[model samples]
Target chain A: MGLFSRLIAKVKGESGSQISASDWQELERALIESDLGVKGVSEIIELAKKERGEDIESSLTSALSSWLSTNSRQLASNSDRLTTVMVVGVNGTGKTTSTAKLASLLNNDGAKVVLAAADTFRAAATEQLQTWGARLNLEVVAGPQNGDPASVAFNGAAAAKESNASYLIVDTAGRLHTKSDLMDELGKVRRVIEKLTPVDEVLLVVDATTGQNGINQAKIFAESVSVTGLILTKLDGSAKGGIALAIERETKIPIKFIGTGEGAGDFAAFDATTYLQGLFQA
Target chain B: MFESLSNKFAGAFSALRNKGRLKSGDLSDIANEIKLALLDSDVAISVAEAFVKQIEDRSLAVLDDVNKSTNPSQAIFNIVNEELTAILGGSARRIRLAKNPPTVILLTGLQGAGKTSLAGKLAKWLKDQGNTPILIASDLQRPNAVTQLQVVGESVGVPVFAPEPGNGVGDPIRVAKDGIKFAKDKLHNIVIVDTAGRLGIDQELMQQARDIRDAVNPDEVLYVVDAMVGQDAVRTAQAFLDGVGFDAVVLTKLDGDARGGAALSITQITGKPIMFAATGEKVSDFDLFYPDRLASRILGLGDIQTLAETAKSAMDAETTAKFEKKFIEGADFTLDDFLSQLEAMKKMGSMTKLLGMIPGANSGAIKKQLEQFDDNELIKTQSIVQSMTPIERNDPKVLNGSRRARIAKGSGRAVSDVNSLVDRFQAAQKMMRQMRTGKGGMQMPPGMQMPPGMAAPAISKPVQPPKKKSRSGNPAKRALES
Candidate 1:
């Protein structure tokens, strides 16, 4: 199955034009399988049924479009001062890699970018970011291993301010949302950076393949740090990234960017039309 | 905001109450709800559908038989558990060592699936099992992937074979072949090849994995996957099955709150047993996967077996006998008894782990309460109880305003806190008395009810729980009761 094809196939698999009970059930299964979640799928099915459209595909697209907002899709940057983007997420969701990719994107656009290796918890995490910084030829400020991450973010903010950099990307350690202490540490890091320079965007990097718990991750992280946007990573795989839609619906946080592959050039701005087309593509 | 899968099943079957026989409509309703729960947990659509259909058919046939149990839901639950266990491959499968000296194991998965971390954990596990394992850093595709593996190897006290300094520089296939040779020359019994995390659809990288597998000819190829993975689990598992053909599955990041329906999806689709699970970030968090435990967890029944084991170790025989004697005699379960039980609970593990072992304990207000719970609360309760005289400990009814004030002063807590502790203890004592008079009826906290048939077997099924059954009860009745 490609993206929402499992659900779309339900509509196309029917012999007649009119929708049947089994078809509806199959559509429900498809939506649930796509990670829309049981509740979200139930709401969508109810709405689609009420609309009584000519087909199931367009109704679901419209239902999804109603929940999605394209206004906040642009990466917010402060014009009068340095824009600081703080990236955070659960373990192995590619927060560090997304931070590097975001910095590289801003740097490639003729902007001076400084990367902050603030992930002082995970082993070799600092080295991973430093290697990316060295490859991109961007300045990276880091602290000692197992040191305070907030202090490192503060240092990165100071370095960006002193160097007159256009942007400072702070990459925090990957911490599960269930860990309250780790979440508090993230808040402290954000507050420390805010003391030097306000964080313009707190992007919660979510794996495209994450299940229903992705909503919990988004909600809890937003509660901790007021997450400004989402960065959906690992889209090159078989996952359709449906959780992004569900998360956006629940949190009202727009996805500013997406990671298509492992390469630095595989990122692009989130376009709602293109994304919806991919989702509903037959 | 979705109810746990076990809760969903409970809700669906709640309609079956007072019904004499299981109707087809009731069966389909239960099946439909179960299907939704499975999907919510990220099980593949086709697999969930097939599984629900099979269970529905089996349940109908079983219910129509002559040997019908009184509780229809319990019968259905047993059928579902058996089918889930069967689909989960019955039991945990360990690694098959090579007949020759150097056994090779290949690790493969998608990007950010924790292949590198799993490599370290597997190496540490093998080392702990009295085997010399060498980690091969063949993940030359990602930036500094080799450094990450080397750091992991160093922490685990295992040597890493990274012939090429990996920054998209060297051939992983050649490195894997050379790694095996190096391992054999050094007399290492095991060689683990850690490959780059790649897309299942990426033909080039999938071919790279295949080439490495062919070159190494490892004894086992483990497909590591994130437990939080959703619908894509089927597609990716299928892709790997066709592209690189793994021998067993290893689920990582089980520490996360995700229900891990991907375990069911991958296991059922590939017909491969899940061998191990990486629960936390540490190498020591890795262990053999238990299918029965995961099945109950996925169903939202909690890990009763693990909880029983932990409680059995922490709870001594004397305390069990004491508690039993008081219960049968209908004696008041005093604050002192509550304090001892609290101490035993503290010894069992963290409050979070204990709370997680109870059904329906992972949601709503209980979750909030769990977050607020700490050992200090237990200590304060202990202090408040200790401050009381023996008479007051025996009967909290004597805890009037003056005594509570004295306890507050002695425990260094507010009077209101001491008063609340006494009130809670009195409430607990009353509940225990009611349980005794109710003939050992299943007395669960509000909203934490186990399936009717599941309560009795929980203690005996997990491990011998206390083993202080009343000798006066009828033996045959006890058998039926259990």
Candidate 2:
């Protein structure tokens, strides 16, 4: 797992010389395994080439880190008005469960929170949200099955405002990028929510195990709603260490939180040092 | 996306075709091109590197001959295609029907990986193959997870065995054990245990999954993986392999725009075969995973095997025969026939996705037409066509202004709707007549040229080589002096 040493060995251990094809190839391998796409890998390799025997680690880290924000990675916790965090992602990425976890995180912090079961598409999705709410002594606002998700968000906004809650996390339905009509409909859902309060954080929940195909999904969401952040879920500890860098580089969206487990308390803000250390860890 | 790579292969082959002999270094460009395509297709980085290396070695081997007279590119494609097929585990393996009754299949994956849905699909798929399957709702962790599996079970026409929550919470392992017992008592030959999934991998979840594995000692423990999980596919697979080793992997959500990298990486990473792939939401939309077919699809070569299967399932012999007779006889293609074909196509799933498999079907016009086309349009078309009298349906020209008005009134559609149907039917009939008379400019999908000795009919089927052989007839080898 000495991912760091392997990355820097060719530079630190070798005599000062121009980076050779083999060195570039090895770096490319590392980048690709990191879930960085072909486009991003080539771009990083080109950047690392200029350093020669210079501090290649920082040069490359900076290149990868440049896509993420330099500011503190925190949610919209301002006490001005209700700060709504709208969670969205394609199906099977744990969007619904992550919503529950996010609610729990906020609840644990003693922030008044209201959950909006805006995903009316799945048959038992609302009940799933309610069950999570019941565990934490929180209430979930939901609408009828196959109802307009935007209206559900609207109802949720009303509920949050009436309770004078500090935050509202709206869980939207899982949809694919290929369906333009549905993608466009997501935009409508956002505008509907924005009417009540700013959607300070529209986190696109992605599975850590997802490959390069997820980049396309993220790109679409970013383009449509200006996705503010990413939430990496299902990180049950594996080599998916590369995707974090690739997604940040591709989507230019900072990863805000990661779902470490299925429990309501398994989420945390993404720390750059810990993640970078993890990449070189194993 | 693979289409671009397919074109690149054509370019590379043509470049080699012009050269009299294969230079060892000439394959470097093709190797890089193929590598980029593999990465784009979601093949893991290290795995893609290894695969490209294999192709490079194979290509150089084809050039080893001194009297070298061969289509080197064709030889390279065969090698590359063969290696890709082999990496995908060669062939589809059906579910292992245990010698003893009550074959238990434990389903496990991260939350939202479509485990519950796959359980229902597996149960239905088994039933279709003449086996009784019962589902066990052991995913008690997620609220309503049990009820969700129950709903899926009812939809698939399979009975669900859910242990009532004891003390407000029942251990998943206990539920799994009791479910198998219930299956034995009820004589349900197959017991599919749908286990709980955490949003992420956790010690507690894995411990429970492992406990269930030990308790049941199931014949088939299938890890249901989402095809959309690209790079994460291998890592998650490795974790599951180590935590709760499974017999096979079940890929779900392939109907989405899956680059198919995870599907490619899982088998290699875990040394397990992908036994089944569930495409759409329907229980019937699942099939045994065929590596060769998937290879062809990934190569941007249309999946004729899948197309044939989809067609065969959707169309009865009588309907196909009637269509053939009408085409051969140059008979007018009626609205009724068009209605039936439309229904068949809709049954096959997304028109846009299906068209990707057919040569020359990825055109903008066709995609646009499919996007505009919907079930409502089909229903309206059906209503309009069905409203026509026998004389009008058989001979639409006889459908004058009065007949059209009467039919529109009967169908509760506008006069324009009826008029549009007749016009569209006439246009289609003209196209069919031209194709039937051999005057139509019909472009067949490449690799699917009409087989010699098989007369061209309106519906053209690709020359289906034996599925197991996987395009073994080498064009490059044939050109070489063996």
Candidate 3:
């Protein structure tokens, strides 16, 4: 059963008149299981209990949707100047794939785009991006193996400016946000891009299945490189991506896109209403 | 980000502290709190509820006999700990090998689950254990998946069987079946078939996994799960169990500060043992999973055994002998020795990770203290030691105020920072002296202390497990020793 249906069943127990303690506990569990985090769950539960007289579903929806931003989930870009977009996250969170998808996305939108393979740490990371660039038929700028990532970002920015591209999506190496040295490298990548032109959007690609640590990842990435938006990837799985709500609630950085599958066409803009409704759907 | 579930568990039990007798209401409250704790750690709702129910039943039984134990909370604690350990698979399980010549091991999981990297780690691990293992790149779904596997295989010095480059051009089932045949032909005793990461609900992909499974009839199918996975763990684990039927589980990205409640959920739902854990990004960061150790970690009691084992593994033979002699002769642990220890500890992994393994290190003041500590702290220490003269490093006693200031200036750190490093070193030196006489009871790394109630397992001296000899004839016992 969907989480909402299960929660409704929990509420409609026996006489179906009043919500019992066990029902509240069930609601809490549902939220916790969705990676809402202990603190986030408790806050929602407290707000939920305070509005017990009203429709539970509507009350919960309002509470959750309030945490999410209704702002435009579109990728920020500059029409006159080059728009530099940096795709970054920890290892294997689909940063490269999402970068390819985003590049294809912008390219289909009738905008000139260039790709940069700034991920030099992981073997075949550049090749991964290069392959995507080849499929998309877009130019890809990559650095030497194990070379400094910032220099690659620098070259990518140069290429984008030279080509007069509308967007330059720099795919950075996946590094754990907790690693200080690696985070420093990410900051340098940003600084290098900003040195040439202002970075329009720094999207942190998060896996849909990430737990409470998602909040920390968002916070650290935002702090390190001023992550402008979030791209929730791997949503093709059964995971509800509820952590995105918690992250948006905490960081106020809206999720720009959702990756439903491995294919480039599976990318879509985030819709808060659809997401909130989907959360409870069976 | 990953709050120690043990801390929450302790909070639950603390309510019943100092009570002469236990009531049913008390047990219920504790049970409720425990359910929340488990849920907070990303344990599936049904699994957490069932686990709490077990705790409630066990606690009520103990309540029936009031005089069974002096401490009711301790009794409950033991019950929860034992139950958790039992559910996590009470003993470590080895990878089951086939009776035939080439043992086919199929790796399956969702995308970004670290299957490609783990295949290499598994191959290298098998190679180290005197087995010829070859990796087969059958993950033809994701872009550059084949290249990733080939790169990982090359790094581990294992041959990869990739007849066709991935990117949806080749049939994975054919590759897997052909890879098994190739392994047999090449006389490779082990064939690790790396498959595409797919969602459990995708029928086509699920059928693909079944096709590969039926084609090669792998001896062991390992479900590679990301340790940071949340509530969907139950559904995904159940799907894989029913759809593909894995023999065991392997947890990846364990180095992240996630509670790893998915471990509990998967094992409980699928009845599979988690055989290995990929702790860090490095291929060598992989290790055999220990249920008792993970159980303790889940309960917020630090994983001291793993930490000690890591320390033992990180230390070279010469360093071990040197420390052993110095420890026995009651010699001072100089700055030079301290510097070397610091460097070796760096090889052990992150300082935050090391401290995180200590009991109560995740809580209040200790956690605050941990914020000041990171890998950078080790780099600073290395630079500080390098700034010192040979004499000063050999004998810290010769270092005067001017020399300390000069060293701090040379290291580009404040004089107070230098002083703190020296103070920490001296404290470590004193602790080493106390340890030699068996008086260093339950102390942690310098500036950290074990919380009052949590008694660290008595590691009187550095546990130096003999790396060369196999004292135990039993394979499992020997595996633990190693």
Candidate 4:
């Protein structure tokens, strides 16, 4: 057995005994070894220690579950009526692909949806979004690749208002989150969309394989615009998916969805309980 | 790695290196090389085209730099690497959370992309970070999806709030809203609403995800994707991002054999930092994404962190200490030690990544082949060793006809297989003995040069003609020639 598995087994074998500080330390060590990150391990350890005198396994599990539920609840309540979501991220991070995927997912759930390709950076980005729009047979507003992204977003929102579309998804240029000018451009787009229609959401498209760096990028993008949620993609690679823990711990942002494959149907909503179960299982 | 793409990269690099310098003719060749590599690796066509244009422009501007460099090949390599990295975005991103309690997270994805699995993974990740999370099973279409969420919830010991399974589709979203309220009342900080996944992207599904976004006002909406889907994954992610305005991406199944081209291209296409990765089915297998580590792995420079982990798992301190002591004393260089080292190597995932880790292992086809050998075969060999009696294992001479038959039966293999194993082991032992004695009898095997920085080459090289492609389009020929 690997060192991590061995440690987990050692801890699990002693589940019935009174938990000691050392045992908690071992568990924390195991978590760190598993790539849970320092912040996550310490947070879990502190919560586990609060129930030191109780059933160790149950307490640890409950503490973890409660912690996850608490974090997710914070994001859940922030969603309000006419919540507009402005999706922005760097190019090739599945920005355009994710836009179509998200549009299909929302449309399936019976929401009035409209898509706008405001990614005026690439010549074919608008066409790519248009292709998905055709497949879904949904209305799409698009501009030339080198045209103004903010203008496209404004026009798209105006179309949404005209059609009384319940949800308007504005696809923006894929720019570096660290680029102040690009980030400022995102702010302009968000403001323009809100002027046309109430902007309810600003979602950052993040690749799951980026680890802690993904979290750092999200922070910068969040600062630039009113980023309300996270959309993590490409789950079927070599990346360990540890950024999920780091992002929540450091940024306290609720992860809304996960993309497991290239299919349009590969997305699913985030569930803390289910996530914990998958995390703890061997 | 995906076999086809790996071959393409190898072929492209070889061709580029052979040309020695950048020229207008080299532009088409480079573009074609890159196009084939990206397409074979499953990068979206549009993205690939844009990348090629950018590379072409950059390459033209850096012609002087390439011409002036001591090694033109290395210079080109740097240019390609730099451009690829830039297109993928130079850094990662974090999420935005509201200051208030009860932040809602709307999760969306297609069916069979491990959306449910990711939901569980995300929940555990959040909980470990001190956030109180509640799971909302809003996927009312798929049969047993609710139960699946509950099963995951029960496993994590977290409460799963969902409408009764028999309820209609819309009911789940309503319950999700109510669950969010309940979680808030209970002092929970986050509510993750796990939505249903469809077989394909359609208007209905997009509406559902958007409806939930409208109803819950989630702080974040994450789109889940499977990385193995390659270019398809990138395309799907874009579609979903447009529909729901998801905040970030959660990639799953990173441990699979996917070339991970999608991961590289996705960031460039979306301008988003990959937030997290699901390496294995186990919850602990999740990790935050790192572009540099991924780039290193892709470039065939083995990931050090993964390598360290493998070593820690496979090598005990006592065994390492013994090996170290023997190396220092110059007395531990035995055939037995070599065999044991081979055994330890079997525990790592593959020979390819390991070989790539060693100095000078990246030069030739033979080295690549050795690295890519099947781990299952190694396991079979390991089992064969286990089946042998201690005497037969330690002393190969003890394995006569009767013993060989017995061993074959124990290992459930043909006697021929057993004999072959013994023969290979004996040949290896003989080679080691010859090396230790420092006799003129010792000579390195063909294609076994000890890398440039290591010990001096022990054998004269053979002059072989450059192999041409066979009519069959066999990649082995191309690889061997390169």
Stretches of candidate 3 off by over 4 Å are: A1-63, B64-68, B327-333, B386-392, B396-482
Report the C-alpha lDDT of model 3 over B419-453, residue by residue, as the tens digit: 55654455566667777788866476522242111
Give lDDT tens digits, candidate 1, residues B1-482. Answer: 12366666666656655466777887898898888778877878889889999998898777766136767777787788888888887987878998897999999998888899899999999999899999999999888889889988999999999989988899999999999999999999999999998888899888888999999998999999998888889889989999999999999987767777888889999999999988775677677888987777655667888777768978899999998998888787777787788788767655565657676565556555656655356566678888899998887666666777898999898876665454345445555666778854656533223211112222223322222233113434422332
Docking class of 1: medium
* Candidate 2 iRMSD in angstroms: 2.3
Order the candidate numbers by TM-score, best to worst.
3, 2, 1, 4
In terms of DockQ, which candidate is strongest? Answer: 1
Model 4 chain B lowest lDDT segment of ten = B451-460
Q: Which of the two, 3 or 4, has more DockQ? A: 3
Q: What's the lDDT for candidate 4?
A: 0.63
Residue-level lDDT tens digits of model 4 in B232-264: 455467667777877667777665444556766
After superposition, candidate 1 runs with Cα above 4 Å error: A1-30, A45-60, B1-3, B308-350, B358-368, B375-482
Candidate 3 C-alpha lDDT tens digits along A180-256: 77888899999988999899899999998887768878999999999989999987788878998889989999999
lDDT of 2 by residue, A1-282 (tens): 344457567565443245567776776776666676778778877765554434666666666665565544677787779998989988878898899998898898899989999988765788889888888899799999779999999889988999999989999988877666678888998999888888888999988777776777888888888888888886655645467567776666788888877678888988887777555443
Error of 2 at A66 (Å): 2.1
Q: Pick the candidate with the highest lDDT.
A: 3
Question: Model 2 over residues B1-482: C-alpha lDDT tens digits?
Answer: 34434554555656766776667777787788777777777777668778889988877766665225456566676787788788887888888888999888989887778898788888898998899999998888777888778878888889999875421378888888988888899999999998887433577678889999998889998988888765657767887888898899998887766667777788877879999988875678788999997777555456887788887988888999998987877787776677687677667776555656775433444334444434355456677878887777777767666777899999999876665455445545555666777885674433223221111212222322222134223433311211
Error at A5, model 3, angstroms: 5.1
Of 2 and 3, the candidate ranking higher by DockQ: 3
